[model samples]
Target: MSRNASASTRIRVAAGAAVLITVACTASATALDRSAETRSPGTPREAAALTGSAKLYRPLGDDITFTFDAHLAAEHRMDPAKATGTFRFSHYLDGRGAWAEGRIDCLLTGGKVAVASGVITRTDLPGAQGNRVGFTVHDVGRHDRLGYSWASVGNPVETKDLPKCVSAAPFEKVKNGTGDFRVLPWDPDFLKEG
Candidate 1:
């Protein structure tokens, strides 16, 4: 039973973190899109309690997130139109690094679907894996959006040491937002190859 408790704790912590990234990534992506086009962002909202869990939320304004979310579209089969979910955010690497996760919730598609989510961890001020995970629901134009993903390390090109995979242009936010990106039922990995 004791072992079970520890395992449970790990699961809970991991789950919380996943939720955070998902929410942050989605919100971040939207902000990125708006930033690039020089357009006003959607009505921002104070992140209410996502379900009953107590997950601290924060505005995503960096390249690590931008990469991860874009990577998702390139890698994970995340539907831009419906890949949103709740997330939990927590500090990592003593304030330099951060991690977040997104959990898929029920939707209007009709049939029962499996829940989904993603995580972005950065180290070296990036998180684990010396990188961050990003989830993005993108606007494919024509009022359509497909999902995006990117997993990378370093900051948004500002810092001299930032990696080639890093770009801050995608994740600049002016205010706090709520409810991460929506979720799709397709296998995420399949999208990466395309």
Candidate 2:
């Protein structure tokens, strides 16, 4: 074949391969986007890692008391076959006006429920003051997705029965903490109650 004819044929082949590759990539991307959109609204969104703040509440008659703020770190589970990933947290339990700090290390199950065990240290008391100690509680909660979370209902496991804390106190019954995991949005218009 003539040199010009040969060169033309090679260029055509290369262009066809490029077009095929572009089509394949576009199809794959569209499939992934659809899957994300189809996930249950209440289910955890697929993310590499999610970071959000949590608020614990104590039911007090008609009004709910804000307990504390907990920082949450959870790995996103996108695949159905993979086991749930680890979730870590550091929280502060409010002592009326003061507060106590705690930490949690646990893994989620099906991105639904998590039973976390953590210690609460009262560093805001009087006399022995800052030297005051606290106990650990077994917390069970549903991992929140869009705008929902679940927590222990009543009396949590104490240190005496489980020996997980230094001291225990006669505290009121804890209701539940409702929470949500959200991506920090760039648009202010997308904001909602936490």
Task: Please name the candidate that would achieve the greatest TM-score relative to the true structure.
Answer: 2
The runs of at least 3 residues in candidate 2 whose Cα sits more than 4 Å from the true structure, single-residue gaps closed, are 1-51, 56-98, 125-194
lDDT of 1 by residue, 8-113 (tens): 9999999999999999999999988866565335422211111212212234533222111211221223343243344333344334655444333211121112
- Quote the positional error of residue 192 for candidate 2 in Å: 37
Candidate 2 local lDDT, 7-79, one digit each (tens): 9999999999999999999999999778768776544443222233344343433332222222222122322
Candidate of highest lDDT: 2
lDDT at residue 172 of model 1 (Cα atoms): 24
The lDDT values for all models are 0.33, 0.34
- Native-vs-model 1 lDDT? 0.33
